[model samples]
Target: MEIAIILISALICMSVVAIKLSDTKLSFPFAMKKQLFTAAERQFLMLIERAVGNEFRVLCRVRLIDLLSLKTDTNKKLANSALLKAGNKHIDFVLCDKNDLTPVMAIDLVYGAGKDGHNVQRDFFVNGALDTASIPHVRIKAKNGYTLAEIRECIETKLIPLRRRQGKIPFVAANDRPEVIKRSTKPTRPLSTSRKAVA
Candidate 1:
């Protein structure tokens, strides 16, 4: 009877051990981030929405590769290097055409970048890449009390002209209606150029 009891106890211990092991093995190391944007980012996004109105769609944390493509004839090794360099990097925000979702400009939120060499270098690479592609990149200082008119000015004064030089004309009417909304109609793209600081 004691032997049988001992065997039963051993079986119960083994079962407990197995259950513990299974629970440990199935446990995940991740928890929900529970947020898509930081408080600052969310506030800025709201400002951009008000600033651009319905003319543009603001995309956040857009990867660099998503905004640019390498030349077809370039060497394989160099292409890989370039791709790897930009693959993980991202623009803070990108303004795309609302109708076609075409990327029109890049915007980075800046907060006294002179102190950070890493950020400065990163911006240099991003600026050079966007400049090469003729895409307008606007750096806006992070602060409170930004008016809608100021953001609108950035798009009108910088984003529009840069794309115009590339023959990518973007048309928008003051009536809160974009000309491209009429699918049967087509027009040239837009252009813009500027790197102004709004104090």
Candidate 2:
């Protein structure tokens, strides 16, 4: 009877794995999302792009692992545990330095005031990680009406100055936010109307 029971258990486990294998082979009922960002997110992204100007490049939907990693001294087991705990969590947007693509600031778009404790804890972890790395974290409320000036003030006036003092931002950037300089291309020499130059 004990042997029969053991055989039955083995069969049940095999059946379970077989079912899982078949499920994995089947195509999931997935549909492609129509848009990556909602209208509000798109608006905020546009504001960030315009506000930071050509100084910084903006990246969206970046994973935390992509931005940060555990210290080298961390043991493999501890590292795996920490990574497993935080894996798959992502930042909404990351602003990077244009020169070497270093992550300058991490931005989270606050959709609404409806966050629960879990979200608060997750944000705490993310913010703490950014702080540990000396990278600034900014949370901007999602609004349809974010002006370029307001975003610029938050980034340039507030965050950039602090990072600049800390030497996080490279001194290569100008004191003033660099603007596109338009040089009107005029003929170096006046075009002679007479065709005699062709001879």
Candidate 3:
């Protein structure tokens, strides 16, 4: 009985030591810090927020994989290809339906004419993916501060046609139309000069 009790005590000590060693081995270092957005991106997001108001939700730096999915069946090759194409890419901004969070439009802020070869290739790939998925996309130049009217114009010109093609009408409810009319009739506020140009 004495020997058994000693062995039991030894076993408990060993177990405690093993647990501590495992915890020490598994410990990892991590840094928690604040992430700063670019000045241009900040300004752009502000513009998008003001332009969309309460009508739509604007999501910034959304991953392509989150927005897109493999439409094909369980073919491994096709699935892998789709993943490879979308895995590392992200859209600058995505306008989503306020009610259901369904993606309505994707906007990419292009600096200059996108003359860089890498940028051109990336643009082609992103545009192709959006087009193949039947998602409307607009490439806006990173110019001096964009006005609310200009942003609305871009949506009307680029997204409305796509929405129509998909048989989706904007604000179909009679009650919703009145709110839109009321908002449209309101005077437009001038954009601030301090707004930064998007890069």
Candidate 4:
């Protein structure tokens, strides 16, 4: 009887341990759901805007665009439309330089929502009309559930590089001599000699 009781107690203790571990695992999703993403996301935008200048604005419009779908004209249109609408919401943080307001940079923070809100980052860019060749709008892929600082740092790294790379067209022409160099000119007679001969 004593042996049986001891075995039963051990089994109960093991079951409790297993249950606790399962509960700890289960609590993560709930914590994620409870996380206040918007506030931190907004803070990140504000930080960038403050650091850069008031000319550029960062827009967080993950809800409007479907990240799972392939890129299409319809998606593009929808994304632009959403940004326009977001502008009305005024959820952006402006970046400014001393000379002028920088062009607004749109960032979409895509999170896997509902059943699919896991391990997905959907981002797109909308070029602002006021944006110039030097300063263009950028799109960034933000990892879901990242802290505010992490998101800001990621955006900075990604966008700074993108802005640097935008207008660069790769050299595609052949290594052969250029057309201008290939044009041969006849030997020119000396100016004095020509004049003397004419005289």
Candidate 4 residue pairs in backbone clash? 53-95, 53-96, 54-95, 54-96, 55-95, 55-102, 112-117, 113-117
What lDDT does candidate 4 reach at residue 28? 52
In angstroms, how far off is 156's CA in candidate 1? Answer: 1.7
63-154: candidate 4 lDDT, tens digit per residue = 22221222355577776765564343321223333355443344433344522332243222323322422333333444435455665565
TM-score between candidate 2 and the true structure = 0.64
lDDT of 1 by residue, 58-139 (tens): 9998999999999989899999988998897788889898889988889887765443322543467788889999888888
Of candidate 4, the 10-residue stretch with the lowest lDDT total is 62-71
RMSD to the hidden true structure, all candidates: 17.7, 19.2, 19.3, 16.8
Error of 1 at 159 (Å): 2.2
Relative to the true structure, candidate 3 reaches a TM of 0.64
| lDDT by residue for model 2 (68-137), tens | 9789999999889768856867888899989999998888887565443214333777877788887888
Off by over 4 Å in 2: 1-28, 115-122, 161-199
Best by lDDT: 1
lDDT of 3 by residue, 1-199 (tens): 9999999999999999999999999998877656556567778888888887898899988888998877756599878987898898888899998999998889877777564321433467788889887778887777786898998888767777656666885547676564533347668878776788899
Report the Cα lDDT for candidate 4: 0.46
Query: Would you list the rank order by lDDT, best first?
Result: 1, 2, 3, 4
lDDT of the structure predicted as candidate 1: 0.81
What is the TM-score (0 to 1) of candidate 1?
Answer: 0.64
Error of model 3, residue 4, in angstroms: 6.8
lDDT for predicted candidate 2 compared with the true structure? 0.80
